[model samples]
Target: MATVRVGEVEVGRVQVGGGVQIAYARVGHGPPLVLVHGAGLDGRMWQPQLAGLADEFTVVAWDEPGAGRSSDLPAGFGLVDFAHCLGAVIEALRLGPAHVSGLSWGGTVALELYRHRPELVRTLILADTYAGWKGSLPPEEVAARAEGAKRMLAVPREKFDPTLPGLFAGDPPAAFVPLLGTMAHDVRPETMGAQLLMMAEADQRDLLPAITVPTLLLWGEFDARSPLSVAHAFQDAIAHTELVVLPGAGHVSNLETPERFNRAVREFCRAHA
Candidate 1:
C-alpha cells in the first residue's frame, strides 16, 4: 500500500482482489465522490475535478485496471469485471453509497455499478459518455469503431497515438496538453483493446429505465463521440435524470470547461446529499 503526494492529494494503491492493485488519488473531506476516467486515460485526467471539488467533497479518482498504476487487464475481463473492481475500491475505502461519476467509457462502468450494486451509488454523474456503442450508436458506427479499435491494437506502442480528433471542439487546452500527451503515451495496447472491444459490444439501454437514483447527464455541446442526441436519449430513458450541456466544449467537457463542469457536479451532489 504505497502512497505519494500529488499536490494536496494523496495518491495511493490498494489491493482490491485477485492480487490486483488499483491506484487512486484522493483529496479533501466530505461526501465521497469517486471519479472513473475514460478509456486510454487514467485518474490523472480528473486532476481538475479533484482539485476543484475537494473543498466540498472527498474526491477520489481511480486509474482503472490496465490503465495507470493499476494492474494489467486479466484474461476474460469484461464490463462486469470493471464494475466489480470499482465496487471493491469503494468498499476498500469504505466509500459506499457514494456519488459515483464517470466519463466516456468510465460512464458505462458507472452504469454497470448501479446495475449490479445499486446500494453502493448515491447519485450518478455521467459525462460525454455512451450507453455503450451498441446501445446508443447506429450499427454502422459501432462496426467502424470496433474496426478502429482492432487497427489501434496492431500499432506498435511507439507509433500509437491516443489523440482522438473529436476530443476537443477546437485545439487541446494548453495546460492539459502535456498531461494528456503523457497519459496517451502510457496507454497500453492490451488495456485499450479490451476496453474498446467491451464498449463496442455493450448495450446498457435495458438498464436505463431501471435506474432509481438521481442521474446528472453532463454533456459537451460539440461532443462528437457521444453527441447531444445520445444525451437526449439518456435523458428520455432514465426516470430521474437532468441534462446539462456545456457550451463550446467537446467530448472531454470537464477538461475543456472545468469551472462549469465543477459547478454542475458540486450543485448536483449537494442537492442530493
Candidate 2:
C-alpha cells in the first residue's frame, strides 16, 4: 500500500496473486474509469486521459504485471492471468462495475476480464484493439506478427526500439514524443516477449457475442495494426456497441487524438454512469 504523487495523479501499487505488485495511476473524482494500456506500454501512456478526463470521471490506469514499476511477468503467464490481475485491481480499489477501457492488446484483456468477471465492468471502451491476433487477423498474419515479436526481443536492450510505425496518421504529436520515447526505452524485452506471445495466442471472438454491457468502439481512422475493419467486426458482434472513428488518428488513437478520444469516452461513460 505505497503511493506517490506525480502532479495531480496518485501513483500506487497493489499486491496481486504471486506477490506481484501492480502499479497504477489514479486521479479526479467521479464514476470509476479504469484504463488498460497496450503491450510494451504502461499506465503512464494514459497521462492524457488521466488529465483530460479527470474533471468528468475518476481515471485509473494500471501498469500490468510486466510493465512500468510493476513486478516482472512470471513465466507461463497467460491472458486469463492478465484478466484475473485486472479483476483484482478493480476489486482491491472497490471499483467493481467500473467503465473498463483498453487499447490494443489491453482491449483483449478487458474482454477476457468481462468473460470471467462481468460484475467488474459497467461499460466497455475498446480503442484500436483486437479480439486477439488469433481471433481478428488471418492465420498467416498472426504467424508473421509473432515472428516479428521474436525478432524484436532478440535485439540488444540498448538498441531495442518499441515504437511501431502507423501508430499515428503521420508523426506523433511533438509534445508527446519525449514521454513516448521514455516508455519505449524502458520496455523490458522479457516482459514484452511474454505479453506479445499472449497477444499472439489469444482468441476472444467467442466472448464478443456474449458481451452484454454497452460498448464504445473508438478507433483511429487509419489504424494499421488493428484497422477499422476489426472495429466493425467488434461493432457487429457486440450487441450494444457504438463505433466512433477519430478522423485523422491511427493505431494509438487515445494518444494521437486525445481530445476527440477523451470527448467520446467522457460522453459514453457519463451516459452509462
Candidate 3:
C-alpha cells in the first residue's frame, strides 16, 4: 500500500478487482463507514466527513474506477461495473455489512450495490441523487444537461479556476474551494464523460423497491442537479428511508456544509448501527 497526504489526512491505496488499484483510507475504529465520491470527484471529496466521522467509526474513502488515483476501468465500464468494483473492494478488505454513503453519481452506484449485493451493505446513504429519468426531463432536457456538462468539461483546466463562486450548489467555505479545483483538474475528462453518459442512461426506478436496507437520503435544498423532487421520490419509493434537506446547501452539501452533513450522518448511523 502507498500513502499520500491530502491536507491533514493521510490517504492510502489498495489493488482490487480487475487488478486495478483502488485508493482508500481507514480511521477511527467502530462500525465501517465507506464513503464514495460523485462523478467528477475522488476519495478526497469526503474530507469533511472523514475528519468528523473518523473519531467514532471506521471512515473509508476510496477512488472509483477510472477516477482519482485508482486504476483504469476494465472492459464494459458501466454503473454495474462500478458497483461490482465497490463490492469487490469490500470483500478484498473484508469489510462486510459496511455502512455505505455516496454523493450524486456515487449515490446511484451505492444503491446499485445494495440491489446487487444487499448482504454486503449494513446501511445506505444517498445524497443529491435520483432514481431514474421518469420524473427527469425528456430527451431534449437531458441533451441540454449534457451540453452544460460538456461546457463545464470543455473549459481548459488552466482557465477553469476552482476558486470561482458558486462552484457547487451552495457556496462552500473559501478554504474548501481550492480543493474542489484540485479535484476538478485532477479528474480525467474522458472518464468523466464516459461516466456522465452512463449516468444519463441509467434507470433504477424499478429496482428501488428491492433495496430493503435502512437508507438516508441527503438533499441540498437548492441542488440543481438532482433537485428536491428526486429526493422526495427516493424517500417515497424506498421502503426504509429518511430524507434530510440541508438548508442553504447546494449539490455538494457534504463539502459545502460538512458540519450539518456529518452531524446528520453520524446521528443516523448511531441510531441505526
Worst 10 contiguous positions by lDDT, candidate 1? 156-165
lDDT of 2 by residue, 109-187 (tens): 8999999999999999999999889999989989998998889889888878777667788988898999998898788
Taking the tens digit of each residue's C-alpha lDDT, what string does model 1 give over 22-66?
Answer: 999999999999999999999999989988999999999999999
For model 1, name the residue pairs that clash. none
Stretches off by above 4 angstroms in model 3 are 1-10, 132-138, 149-167
Residue 118 CA error for candidate 1 (Å)?
0.7
Model 2 lDDT-worst window of ten: 158-167
Candidates sorted on lDDT, descending: 1, 2, 3
lDDT by residue (tens digit), candidate 3, 1-273: 567766656577777656878878666678989998887788888988888998888888889888887887776778887888898878776787999999987888887898789899999999887663333446675676566666766888665432222336645668787887788788776677767777767778888877888999998888877788888888878899989999988888898778999999999999888
Ranking by TM-score: 1, 2, 3
Error of 2 at 264 (Å): 0.1
TM accuracy, model 2: 0.97
lDDT of 2 at 154: 91
Model 1 — TM-score against the truth?
A: 0.98
> By TM-score, how accurate is candidate 3?
0.89
